[model samples]
Target: MKSVLLLSVLSAAAVSAQPKLTLKVHTGKGQTGYDVNSTMIAGEKDMLVIDPQFTLSEAHKLAAEILESKKNLALIYVTHPHPDHLFGLAVLHQAFPMAKIVALPATVNAAKTGWPARQKFWFPTYGNNIPGPDPVLPEELTEPYLTFEGERFPVTGPLQGADGPGNSFVSIPSLKAVVTGDIVFDHVYFGVPKDAARENWEKTIDQIAALHPAIVVPGHQGPGATDDMSAVTFMKRYIEDWDKNAAASHSAAEMKAKVLAQYPNLGMEYTLNDRVAAYFPPAAKGN
Candidate 1:
């Protein structure tokens, strides 16, 4: 009789410790031509968010979702300093003041440094739709992990990329998942800048692949989290193809044509053309 009671108590405890995670994805079209993803992870008692959406309207929608969850907003993790990733944080902060907003130290610094310039650049395009409220500077993520209801949420990397430092991922081991920011891309064409460190980005991908996350929440692209390798594989192919062809091309149009011919189905041709023009500009006349 005592043994049976003990077993029941232990089983209940185990179930409580391993609460199921309810994931909600808020997707928005970035003005820069790619999609942005903001993932919300709700547990039994509290909820955590990863990389809130890109605009005020998108952030409000995400905030609404959090309000509907009816759980304590525990934390908001900004994966990197990119405007699309950090711009919506202020909105989330206003809605959930108790929720801790944080990121890797370097990421926080980058966000602070670039916020003003980015606002200037994007405001004209987004106009009244851009971030108007004062920006909220996120606190530094001092620890390497987070805990909610006694479950572990480990963070990894200042993953270096062509875009420079400040890339990171949050691993929910129990769920066998990871929220990868810009380190991995989905079906969209990746933003490859001039002097991008292609080799380094490849190494970062290998590092993420090592985690063997069953579900990936990529920063851009579609379908939200999925148990597949399509995102990683597609990103690898895109980068390699770009690297191989970039040197051979002399003009942005030529590069765009070459890449589009190879990957006609890849969305965001405008982004590709913009990157090519910005990185591989045409030589000035009479040079």
Candidate 2:
């Protein structure tokens, strides 16, 4: 009996010794190929959690770290409108009711309505392009309270090619970090700028670049961003490549196949709802 009690005490101590920020990152599970982090903002008692991990349990797990460490849950911020990025919102809210949800006004509006349009476009046309119903926020929050209007490129929408709401950015003044969501998919999605933004992709990047946050919190990676800010250049390069290939690959299937063949890792970007095989074609035609 005494041995069991001693073991319990040791386990409690081990849990107690782990840092709160470290605990926020559950390396064991709930990661959908993304590294989640809840930063230690300078002035806020409650943390400025970025992305909030990948699952309901993961959100619960993040909340558990706060509750255990006695930290206030100030707000949960989503960089953009992507499933793997924001699936934890409902769970986080369940744990931290008072915590406000923050995002660019456009992100909120787009997430509320834009994703569904993409769903409609892709489902019947392609059948298995994406995996789930368009992601909807908890019905309780109607209007986005916080707004970030990037002056570098103002958001005027034709929403041309991509169904994403609009490229938008926000500043966590306390953290000095700009939450850059799907607008910036690191170096990986750089080749497919149109895949993310149809209308104002460039403008959004300019806005974000103008702020030049000391640190940037992208949707799927860790902090300390030294590169990948050359999104505009990379995107332009991608468009040039696409145009060069357009003479031969005109159909959507051809475009899809070429994209997959060129970047095999991109086929790895699918969520549970996305189609793995379709994303990667039998071969890059004219091989």
Candidate 3:
């Protein structure tokens, strides 16, 4: 029994010490994602980074893993305005200043409008546990512009869609895929907050699908087809259900039962329960 207990303790320690697995999307050198494997393009000199992982510790660990491949991480592309895919950047930037921060037409514009408010609101609920990066104050920097999107964007006339359909794109012809931001989410959870509109999100996904990328690197989740069709399908279904219930219509208990009944194989533990409570109406207790 003592021997068995010792072996179990060793096994647990080994598991805890194992660094998080990263999915590498490119055939190139050390350029790989630390967690969900970011898509990278290898140049003669440097490599371009897709979205970094979500937390500071995750980013630090990811960086150490990349150094093992013996390549320099050059640019960072912020996929969209969502905090999960884009927040690790502040610390990453401080670590790799040479790397450029790139994005779409309204990417930062959306963040500029939403992040401050979200930071304020989310702090009350999640702040105490979140990894704090002490982001460089927004104004302390001059944001970069996209080369394809033109120095002064909203390129009028035929490309008016730069902010919409005909949005600007970044291509590392060598890689055969663009690091699409939140334009694509694979087998993962997706719930939009006030800053993001479902319709706008859908539009971006449609545009990404049009790109015909062989390996589309979504902002979150593991790398997959840029045209991952399932996200669109799942999102559409959720929207339909959400619309039917209309935020305030369902009581808490009914909401929980409805979620369990409909998505029996869905969220485990308190996560699903919390989302229901946070996003839905209160239960008619003792009913």
- Tens-place lDDT per residue, model 3, 104-186, is 54655665666676666645655532334344222211333323211121111111121123233344333345455444444
TM-scores for every candidate against the unseen true structure: 0.84, 0.53, 0.57
Error of 3 at 71 (Å): 1.5
Q: In lDDT terms, how accurate is model 1?
A: 0.77
Better of 1 and 3 by lDDT: 1
**Residue-wise C-alpha lDDT for candidate 1, range 1-287, written one tens digit per residue:** 99999999999989776547867666776554247888788888799999977777888888888898888999899989998889888788888999988888988888888888898898987765667645677898888876766787888878765455668888888777878888777777777633446667777777768878877777777433253456887776777788777888877778888988887765444477666776586577986
Candidate of highest lDDT = 1
lDDT of 1 at 49: 92
Against the true structure, candidate 1 reaches a TM-score of 0.84
Clashing pairs in 1: none
Each model's lDDT comes to 0.77, 0.48, 0.48
Model 2 vs. true fold: TM: 0.53
- As for TM-score, the candidate ahead, 1 or 3, is 1
lDDT of 2 at 16: 71
Candidates 2 and 3 compared by TM-score, better number: 3
Question: What shift in Å separates residue 200 of candidate 3 from its native position after superposition?
Answer: 3.8
Candidate 2: regions farther than 4 A off: 1-44, 64-70, 79-85, 102-163, 173-176, 190-199, 221-239, 242-268, 271-287
| 80-162 per-residue lDDT for model 2 (tens digits) | 55544555676677678887776555556656776676556545633442334646353222343332221111222222212
